[model samples]
Target: MSRYQEMAVFAAVAQAGSLAAAARQLDLSAATVMRSVAALEARLNTSLLLRSPRGVALSPAGETFAASCQQVLQAVLDAERSVLGLHSDPAGQLTLSAPLLMTPQVLLPITLAYLDTFPEVQVVSQARDGMPRLLEDGIDIALVVGPLPDSSGFAIPVGTVRPILCGSPAYLARHGRPATPDDLRQHRTVAWTSAGYVTAWRFCHGQAVQWFKPTPVLSCTTQQAAIRAAVAGLGLTRCLNHEVHRELQDGLLETVLDDFAPERLPVHLIYREGRRATVRVRTFLDFAVPRLRTHPALNG
Candidate 1:
């Protein structure tokens, strides 16, 4: 006689088009389905269904009530999911993706910490240079750098990185540091190429607009290779601050033209549509956002 059970049975009967079929669907005796519907009709003081030899059909009242029932049922299930997400320690494999250079510096540490804290969750991380369609590709979360193009997805601002010019001490000692953007033309530079945009750098220096195209003595397709060449004093290069943080700390690299540093590169954590966020993903964001906010390697 419970209203919930009555409504559920009514919905099943309406959907299945017959008491026998509805009983089969609910795995209950046909008598049970009949009594539930009867109780429901009595409680409402209206006949909600029409019984015929051919099949079952909804009465005028039943037709209207069934639509309402579907909405109510969906709301109840959504509420349950919301509460479960808030209370439960989520367990499942979380798949994440990020650009190749960004993966090591930004995503890796957060992932390591997440695993240590949440032993129940497993991570599958992929490094790629381009963003994938989360719904189509089945990615749970992604770390993206720079300004994002307009699209449908949920995103939270995590951090920022500044693109700056850096060179080895030995290289600077031999060629001298570029005091101004104009000096870049005299230096042997390492070019990092990606996405078909090459030979352009943007900077600002005390009311002066400057752009430079370095004559490439060495060109690299990967950030690691570019950093390696710069570390070996092959040429001056431009890179995000975090990419050379360790090298800078170890005195393997020094930043030049600081006054002309480009605008901070924005970082974002994006997720797929209708994706139920688990505790593992939530916990990592909580811990990671704070650290990223204060880290000197990133722009505040």
Candidate 2:
């Protein structure tokens, strides 16, 4: 097999965690997939995967090699897309990543519109609550909310979202709306947690910021789940304005302590810096930026 094919198979196997799974994904037999990975290891003169009946686990070196393979494969794909851009109509697959809650509320609409406008383009979107490594995840673009740390991507500001503390009308009527950030202590809360620990709820008053680490009556990993919990009259939950915009509009939820809400979080469409923009990416960005900036939820 060609070096590129070998690397591609290796990367596929690593991602799939089993030879049979990778074979299924790549439309090859399990033995062929195993042999390709084994050949790659022999050529490198090092053990890459620790094979077991359950699946294969990448060794430390294999982990680094897989990352490199992904980058190389991505570069090849970019080159192909650039060449294809010479055509009149853009036609290619575009992968995107964004927060889980924002996907349905915001990104999905934009994607559907883009698809309708560009018949030849296909979209593969992944939504997760945690930050995704764009390169590692093969994401062409990422819709990120809140402050961003130092990165090599070009962040284009599309809009802004403010965190809102809200709960169902029934929940608020029973527990009473929190008059201040500290007043949240006395109310039941639906909290978002990461790694089994609840994250602190942050609020602002003028120039001062405060945090409340409430013992949640219900804890969830996804913003959508917490919002649902709050809407079910379980307790108050904190979420981005856009996440609960529909519920708020439908009177299923009501905001509390709006005066103490923090400054709006900047929303950004981030892509790798110094990379050639594929026609699909450029077209989608041109179509999406303005719509997102003027979106009702973000504006309100």
Candidate 3:
């Protein structure tokens, strides 16, 4: 097999996690998929995968090689599409990652609009509370909120979202509203946790910053769940303004301690190095950046 064919087979097997699944995807026999991968290992003189009844797991070396293979394959596909003049009409699978709550409220609407404009493109979205390894997860784009670590990728500033402390009208009416950050101690809170530990609620005013570690009456892993709990009148919850915009608008929830809220968190649309960006990625950026930056909820 040619080097390109070998790389394609290896990448497929790595992604599918099983020879049988890879074969099905490639419309080749299971033995053929296995042989192609085995040939690649032989050529490299390194064990690429550990096969078992459950599935195949890449070795450390395999992980490194697979990343390279994916890049090469993508470059090749981009080249072909460019030559065919199809690059102007972006078409391919785009994998996007963002926080769970933001996916439904913010990201999904943008993606749906993008798809409407470019029907040829397909999107696969991954929603989780915490960051996922962009390269490992094969994410084409990520909508990240807050400070980003120094990295090779390009990050385009979209807008900002500030955390808002809010609760159902009924909950606030019964328990009374917190007038200041310090008064939160007397209130029950629905806290959002990451990796099983609740995150401290932070507030700021002028030069002062305060961290309130709430002994939450209810703790949940996702912001969406915490927002739901708060809306159900369980307790007060702190989340991004965009996450609860509809509820706040409909009079289901009301914000408190607005005077002490922290500075707005920066929102960014991140992707790999610009030189490596595919047509779909660039197109999405052009399509999304202006809209996101102008969004009232994100900008406020």
Candidate 4:
């Protein structure tokens, strides 16, 4: 077998933690797996696995070697993809663009898990401020929230998220809950303004739409910063449901104006093409679509 093949075998063994387990995972015979592992150790002049009656474990050198193995293997795959193009193997780079708020909270964990699951696939995640041009940007997929003005891709509806107004229990107790968006004037409002001084919060109940411009006690550039300030009892903050998912679950914040919520923005996984897509893109979309659809962070 080739050196790369040997490294792949050893890496699988390290991950599975046993020769038999790795063999099963790779769909290779136990004897072939064992031979590959032995060959690797002999060639490197190092003892990699320490076998026990129960199972096998990586030695100290093996642990360090395994980490490098993953890196090297990924680098090789990346190079191969660049040269050959992804026709058959689900191994290559996939670029995903998304809104900044969705990246860390709603997308990072899933992407990290995808990397683990598809060992040969590398991900490039871009946090976009505006709608992405997938074909122009060479992006494989985009996780978008809300309406698309361009609407030029194959969209897979994932879920929905709405703008939420929330405040800490302490702040609510100090200045009773705002019954309506207009009542926010009675309370300190923390508005998210990247470059502006004021914010017009729109509320929609059925067909009636109302706009309330809050005089913010504190204005933040980032949604997370606004949420933090609100959590500290500074004031009520407005953000998407995905932003305060953990906060709501942990009881750090409570929703204030559910009845006046403006609109539920649909989340979509937009890709440039369907059948013509690379194997890397197809596999990634299949992995991410269902996960995002059911994730509580974005779901209404």
Candidate 5:
């Protein structure tokens, strides 16, 4: 068994908890993964993994080896990337993840344009509505909105989006428009709970911050679902300015309480620490950030 190949396979399995997930990620068969793991264990003269009915767990030996393998494997990739002619040209697959709503609002357009510019690079997009650990999930880069939890990683604040209080014209007609944070309490509201709290909506004018807890008429796991419910006139909903920019422009929805809009929520492009900032990733950020700021709806 090739030592480097074994290291790569072990690292893949460690990153992906299941053999099936590792196989799919590596574009290999489950049998191949099993064989590689077996070969590695034999060469090391230690059982690295404990297989059971539930799933595979790394033994103490495996835990020590996995971290070393990741470091070694990353060094190898870095060396190869440095020498590879296409490395400077950014010719490789880039895996990205973001919230479901941001997929259409921000990432999709940038990805489309990126593909057009770098035909040699393939972009794979994953929708992770809930916060995802970039390294654990094997995501090359992640676009995160709102504040992030404590983690060891690199974050680039590319831009920000302001939340807009909006609803379909029909819904506003029925529930009445909220002119201030206090008015939201009497209005039917669509709540998006997957990202964070549903009942609390914050608004600010100058230094004063006021929060409102609306009577949620509908709740959904995703921002997209909340926006959809609002579009269908189920209830008033709030979302990032970019999420409903086109809809508002096309007269599908209308914004209310713009004067009392909340502070700009941060948008970030984050990646694991020490992952080489590839030329492709840098290029996309350079192009996308400036354009995103100019977008009429987003508040930079």
Candidate 6:
């Protein structure tokens, strides 16, 4: 294999922390990653990685060489992107990630439009539930639904979503509407157990936030089930406002305690690699940002 390919393989191994993990990231076999590293080390006349049954760690030389490889590869990529041609159309593959529920309704339309606009570009998007390791997973960009983590990467504000409380009209008619957080105790609840058994739900009133623990009649592992229970008049439930849009529009659910709701969750387009981002990555970000910022469902 070429020195360029070998260096790229070694760099992937160093970043991923294991040959198997690196192979998975690169879509190569474990044996191929091992061979690349071995060949690179033989050519350099020094061991780069310390091998083990559990995983691999960089040797002292490997650490230094790994840094150089990253810099060199990045520089090469940047140069290639810049030198492709002055009039050359943007053409490359981009991998993206978005929240699971938002993909179909929110991101799908934008993606299809982008494909129509840029026929030379290929796209692969994964519906992810939480923040993904961007570099390790080779994700070019992600649409994050909550507060952005510190130094996660560059972010462009999109909009916000509220954690809303809702119940069927029938359920509300029987249980009475909860005007305050304390009234949650007098009602049946359907709890989403994705984050474990949720005993308490938090709400904001005036300028203060408080938690109200309600006894749940049903505990569901997925949000869809919890929402379904609420729609069937089983009990009240809490979920993001956009998640229940169709149900609310259809009169299957009605939001309660809006005055007690906290500040809406902020959304953003987050991407790593900053200035080193490829032409396809940069092009997609530019194309996607304005459209995302104006999304009605995502922003309050």
Candidate 3: tens digits of C-alpha lDDT, residues 19-135: 889999999999988899989999999999987778899999998888889877977898999999887888878888888777877888889999999999999899865556678
**Comparing 1 and 5 by TM-score, which wins?**
5
Q: Cα deviation of 295 in candidate 4 (Å)? A: 1.1
Worst 10 residues of 2 by lDDT: 81-90
Q: After superposition, how far is residue 134 of candidate 2 from its true place, in Å?
A: 1.7
Cα lDDT tens digits for candidate 5, 1-300:
489988898888987988888999999999999999999999889999999999998998987888778756755665687786546666666778988767886678878987898887788799876577766665768888888777827777767788888999998888788877887778788988865556678888888998887668888987788888988998888788878877888888998999888878777777774456666667666766676666564553
lDDT of 6 by residue, 259-299 (tens): 99988898888888787667777788888888878877776
- Report the lDDT tens digits of candidate 4 across residue range 183-259: 87788989888876666888998999999888888888887899999999999988889878888989999999899
TM-score list, all predictions: 0.67, 0.78, 0.88, 0.70, 0.75, 0.74
Give the range where candidate 5 is weakest over 10 consecutive residues by summed lDDT.
291-300
What is the clash count of model 3? 0
- Writing each residue's lDDT as its tens digit, candidate 2 over 1-300 gives 999999999989888887889999999998898889889989999999987777679998888889779768866876775576644466777888888778888889989999999989899899865566777677778899878878738788888899889999999888888899888889999987767998788888888999998999998987778889999999998888989878988999999999999889888898874346766778888888899899887788
Score residue 61 of candidate 4 by CA lDDT.
88
Better of 2 and 3 by lDDT: 3
Pick by TM-score: 1 or 3, better one? 3
True-vs-predicted CA distance for residue 287, candidate 6, Å: 2.3
- Residue 292's lDDT in candidate 2: 89
After superposition on all CA atoms, what RMSD does each candidate show versus the true structure?
12.3, 3.9, 2.6, 11.6, 5.0, 5.9
The local lDDT score (0 to 100) that residue 103 gets in candidate 3 is 80
TM-score, candidate 3, is: 0.88
| lDDT of all predictions | 0.79, 0.85, 0.88, 0.85, 0.79, 0.85
Better of 1 and 3 by lDDT: 3
| Model 1 stretches with alpha carbons more than 4 Å out | 1-87, 195-197, 273-276
